[model samples]
Target: MSGSTAGPEALEPLVRAVLAALADGAARRGGPVPAGPPDALAEHVAGEYAAARGEGALSRLTSLLAYGSADPADPLCAAHLHCPPLAVAVAADLAVSALNPSQDSWDQAPAATTLETLLLGEMAELVGYDERAAGVLTSGGTESNLMGLMLARDRVVGRASGRQVELAGVPRRGPRLRVFTSAAAHFSVQRAAALLGLGEDAVVPVAVDRDLRMDPDALAEALDRCADDGGLPVAVVATAGTTDTGVIDPLRACAELAAEHGAWLHVDAAYGGGALLSDRLAPLLDGLALADSVSLDWHKLGWQPVAAGVFLVRRAETYASLARRAVYLNPPDDEEAGYPSLLGLSLRTTRRADAFSIAVTLRTLGREGLGRLVDACHDLARAGAEAVRSHPRLELCSEPELTAFLFRYLPARGPYDPVRTDRINAALRRGLLREGRAVVGRTELPGTGPGRVRLKLTLLNPHATPADVERLLHAVAEAGRAEEAAEEAAGRHTGETGEETP
Candidate 1:
């Protein structure tokens, strides 16, 4: 029996059941993440699938699987960039999938292609790019960075040489291609270099300032030395929001230096690109438009669903370097028909309609609302930092440059033991995860001596209050004390006295 043979009346109950489940899940928001695996639920679904198959109801299996994933509503789910997407975005995502719009070709997805271009225009305008700018919707910041690097490589080596090298598998004609970025820059830059056949060694890590921002002087020195050493300075990557510290590098200075050295400038603003929405912090990214390319993730700060990232270039013709015509895919005839395929400009083909969700999100939450969200997150971060500073056991590393803070638990009196400190901090983090209290991140900073590892909190959740952050900190301190007590008791039993455990 075909699924089309089923009457609408038969599907009404299943639809209602799915909607009810979604509503129940939505109602359980603002709590700690579920601690246990959802395997039991999955097993139940597997049994149901088997039974449904027996009953010839296999058509419903896809819907069942789509609706049955583990709920992220639980509050303890603050581990990564994953968040419960906005309601508007969720609805738009469903519509996008149902339409199955592919932005690769206009014949397949006419509206989707135009929508993506419009959304790209909006994003470029947000980053101060003019109408002459062109961009493509990417999977995420990583893909965007790779696309920008590929363009940089092609531009630096000349278009014809780049094509010959790619097609004929010949060596690049340019000097040893090199890229520069702060040590704190995201790992994607190095990954991009490697993917472009430049190897990891091609990415030179510039020193960062005390606040974790890229040091302009260090960048200049690195570029000059690279040039003098017969290395082709391909591009300089300036990070807007670093992964750990959320630090925005000196963009204006970096842009000026890139221009002076005739190097391509790519700003990885995947995390901090939303700062452009803010009146206060927008100046921090003042020179973003001056870059040859910029990467922005609407999924990060725009509160859109995942896979919402854009790669914008200042010169529209820069993308011509990536343009290639395939007879079966995008024939020359299609080019004259106003049928522009995003495939030529991006690393992806048959891409999703991620831009629709972003468009819906931006339309629902206007520029003012977006700016307010950014400002609110920054304010909440500051409040959290103040809470950490006021706490007796915690120490704020420095004032937050953006909506992130790095701090560690400080011993109240005794001299700091790096080994003991690491154990206590690790224990505190484990306890928090085990107890399902909070999800604070951990990072290691290489110091002059043995280096020190500390806890980091990324304050992207605008709804998170200072009280919530304080509660998490207090939990960390309590966990630290409990671990110390356990260690002391073990030491007493072992007759080790005050000696630190390895």
Candidate 2:
């Protein structure tokens, strides 16, 4: 029997049980995360999927999984891109999943086709693109960046040789194709180059300033180097809200340079796109409008669910490279008959309705509501930095920029040993994860010591207040202090004794 054949009665028990588990989990998540050993959790989960004495087995499974999840939904979670999604967006996602619309062909998803276009248009406008702009819903920043680079390459190689690289493969142009991005830029740009057949060597890392922003002078120098090496500029990928530090590149300056070099400008605002909602923070993206293309991920800072990525281009023709005509999807007769289709302008033919959730979220929160959320995160981050500075164990590496702070801790009384410090910080993170008290992030400062072990605090929780952040810092400091103390005690014990049986 097909799983879908199960009646509502059969599902009712499972539904109620799941809801109950979810309710309990949510309530528990408000306090502390259950940071248990992964191996133990793995054993329980394995048994759940395999064993079958099962009357309320699903309830047992739900409870087990709920416990197993690190529960990043907790406001204490400042680790990575994970966060609790907006309620309105989750509701919209439920409808989307239930309806299950695929917007490739008009007949299959007429409303969704039109709706997604309108949504994309709204997003393009937000990026300061006019009505003529074109965009498509992508999986995330990686896919969006990939799409942008693909188009950028096609426009460069295609215009010169009058041959479609998408159809014929990377044309052997005389000048080697090159891409440029800030040293602080996301690694996705290099990935984009690799995917576009440009190879990783095509990516030129432009130097950044003290604040971790892409230096315009460095970009100019790199472009000149590319020219000197007999290479044509393909794209300059600017970043807004870099993953490690949340630093944004100089957008307007980068755009000017890209135009001067006749290269495509693609802005990756996956984490900082939420700032566009607020007039105050929006200026951070001052030259955003001038870009040839932009990438936005609503799932990151916009509080949407996973995979709310949008790839917007300045003109519809920018997407010509990705277009394809199929008899069943977009035929010649159908085109003439005014039947709309979205089989083109996307890497996937079976794309989900990612726009609906974003639309619902925007409608519910409006621009001001979303802006406040962004501002709150930014303000909280700055405040959190101050707190980190005042903390006994913690130290601020730099001021918070775009809701992210990178810092480290004082593990013990001894002088700073790079290797020992690295070990303490790593152990601190492990201790936190093992205890599941607080979820903070860790990063290594490039070219700093053996490894400049730094903690990353991504303030994405708008609801978290100053006190909440203080608590988070306190927890972090306590963990580090505890680990360092234990290590010191262990060293003392070793010195007192014969230093281990070995």
Candidate 3:
């Protein structure tokens, strides 16, 4: 109905209602998220849905969604890699949704096919790829990673066994294929390996340095071991921004080592690719141009809506592994007639026109505008790290590399107890969530131990100020104090209950 000629007129009133409902919902359950236990929030949402049995279902459901969302735009909601999208991008996405053009075939999405092709070219250039590069828009980093590794598998394993992997499947007696990546790399690598018929154990985790970046020497040793054991080194995945600390592995070293071992180099820049826009931070990813494939997510730092992920390869020829044909979609005659189709480039059969939003954002802001926003967030993170260091109860764990830092709250009065400290840090984050005061991230430093737990703050909102970050930290400390008091009170209660019947 939204695609009809009268749709615009019909949508005007509905759009206004949705806007009003959004405001009302945000005002009703304020802070970062709805304040209550998880079950209570769920029940309230169920009740709203059940009550909306008539004409106003849209208004009620939209209101409930906005109310329940963990608002990334809120300064206190520095929890994850989620970003607040720009208004221009959101508006562009609305146009795409109304039209509903599927990108799988040429006739289905003529203009969109061209737009996505051009956008991928520009993104490939951003990753230092030449004109021969080819890529496709994806759901996010996870899918992009899968595409990259799938290509690596078919190319490497197929060559070693001299057979088409797509037809015969991985040869049981062929050389073993191994993927080398830093221990800090995203878990998607193992998942991709498993999905490709290479068991999860095929992934070898190389050691990382003190800063949590992959050590190049360790990678070389792993590659050597794999080759010595009659295994083929299929790919080396390097992290441009690790999830917890935002540390980039030594890219130049990893690329060189991968090349020496005849392995594909794939850089997972899902979190740090936004730095490419900033002149100040671009130098950090010096060897990224050497990678055979790269994965980027605009939803993280590019300020676009979700599903704005891209996967690019250095040469178009390498994408042959993903090529496909369907008579109903893109016949040989259609291609010869110059009616290009995007069916061959993607693993998906039906895809949204997600590129439109990213293209609009790029034209609206340009490089310098977005770069300034990136710099602003980075500055806010530096200010936050300083605040954490100066606070008496907060202990700074890692320095900010992009726009995130890790730190944890220490007990104000007691001597350090790793077990108790971990518990306090864990409880404080939930305590803030329960009160609807703040939304902070919690993670553990890599290793096995009680003291590994740490709180994280991923600063993505450029409009957020240093004072806002300071207030967030203060709230965390206060919550930590409250948790400590509760622990002591519970301990006293247990001791009193266990007392002999005097």
Candidate 4:
């Protein structure tokens, strides 16, 4: 076992082998990803699995997995909200993994439970919540959003009907319960509603402005319309950072509306919560403190590994709906005897000690150090946006609010043909993936239009230079040109032979 006295001695050799395999795999790939089609990687994986011979299996498979992965650390791999984890954080994670503590019971993870409690308290203060606030670490934004909506449903909906939602279910004959979020808000809100037995149709999509942020006026109108239709507003979910353009909805305005309507305000700040670290950007989240609950994803912007998500609430008492009394986990006698338990705080039973790594990371790199990293990435995004604006082939969809921007490539020789442009942009992204030249992101704008397709640059790597951004853009333009040329050639051949060629 890793917790045994001889754990370090046993791990040393295995870790060394794994490290060697990683280096070898990265060296062989030599780019963000392996240059080939999806099937090629699949076949390689199959071959490796079939050829695994007893002792060396770990090394062989580790190397194969590393080679196939799209390395987020690579400057060119600016695809999703995925960040390259800091070495310090990863090292801390190793310690947590070795011990393998579960936080469901106090006895199972004594120190871990304490650390998680303290971490959540600090995070609550950072979010402007008072000492009565409480939170729990989550897998990511999806679970966080679900928890927030779930509390909102039980607290608000239950209060209105004067019934306990946990013991009793949602009433069928009550006023229609509704949730309001921006058109650009994360899809998790609707999914959460569905999971809570409120059908997907219960969500009212508030219109967004040109910048893809929720219009406060539109939100007000929607709320009024819901009231007019005798529908109860359960919650208002405001997105702090939209995935496509990174635009934040007007928080203060949304908060005001939610309060006036007696609706619970849940801010999905999974992408923008990192702004709290930076003095320059923290002001953008001015009214975040007013939220009833908030979701933050450290994996996206806190430079932690995957699944480092946090969910917080304004008051601990609001979490009553999730309280539990498992005799083995958190018995009344244990609580009376002053032994703490975290079984009631999570949607999970056997939860890992994820807070340990976050605590280590916070201590190692103080607030100032993490803030600087946030500023660096923000600076990089601004610089990259300027580059996109200056380029003839690139068209900036909007200036970045956080660390991501949206832009599309324009063909060098074509008259403005929206359909053809969309096709070329889509094809170019796939072309880059096949060639392993770059790993850029792709997304469509809010509307269903011919020109909605856009390439994205989510610059999460703070160390990546302006030159790297310029080079990635150039690679995208080159790929776009190749795709355009192929399309034109195909059209010419079809015109000559009167038959479409493959």
Q: Write the per-residue lDDT of candidate 1 for residues 110-220, one digit (tens) a residue.
A: 898888888888888999989999998888889989988888877765542545444444254556778999988889999988888889999999998888789999999
What residue pairs clash in candidate 4, if any at all? none
Measured by TM-score, how close is model 3 to the native structure?
0.97
**What stretches of model 4 exceed 4 Å from their correct place?**
492-502
Per-candidate clashes, comma-separated: 4, 0, 0, 0
Assess candidate 1 and give its lDDT: 0.77
Total backbone clashes of model 4?
A: 0
Q: After superposition, how far is residue 442 of candidate 1 from its true place, in Å?
A: 1.0
lDDT of 1 at 352: 90
Q: What are the lDDT scores of the predictions, listed in order?
A: 0.77, 0.82, 0.91, 0.91
**TM-score, every prediction:** 0.87, 0.93, 0.97, 0.97
Residue 86, candidate 1: C-alpha displacement in angstroms: 1.2
Please provide, for model 2 over 259-313, each residue's C-alpha lDDT reduced to its tens digit, 9 standing for 90 to 100.
9998999999988787898777888889999988899998888988887999899
Candidate 1 residue-wise lDDT at 263: 85
- Candidate RMSDs in order: 4.3, 3.4, 2.7, 2.2
lDDT of 3 by residue, 1-502 (tens): 6777987888788889999998988888788888988999999999998999776998899889999989999999999999999889989988898889999999999999999999999998888999999999999999999998998888888888899887788889867789999998999999999999999999999999989999998999999999899999999999999888888999999999999988999999999999898999988899999999999999998999998999999999999978999999999999999999989889999999999999989989998899999999999999999999999999999999999999999987556777777878999999999989999999987789678889999999999999999999999999999987886766632222233121
Q: What residue runs in model 3 are displaced by over 4 Å at the alpha carbon?
A: 492-502
Task: Please give the range of 10 consecutive residues that has the lowest summed lDDT in model 4.
Answer: 492-501
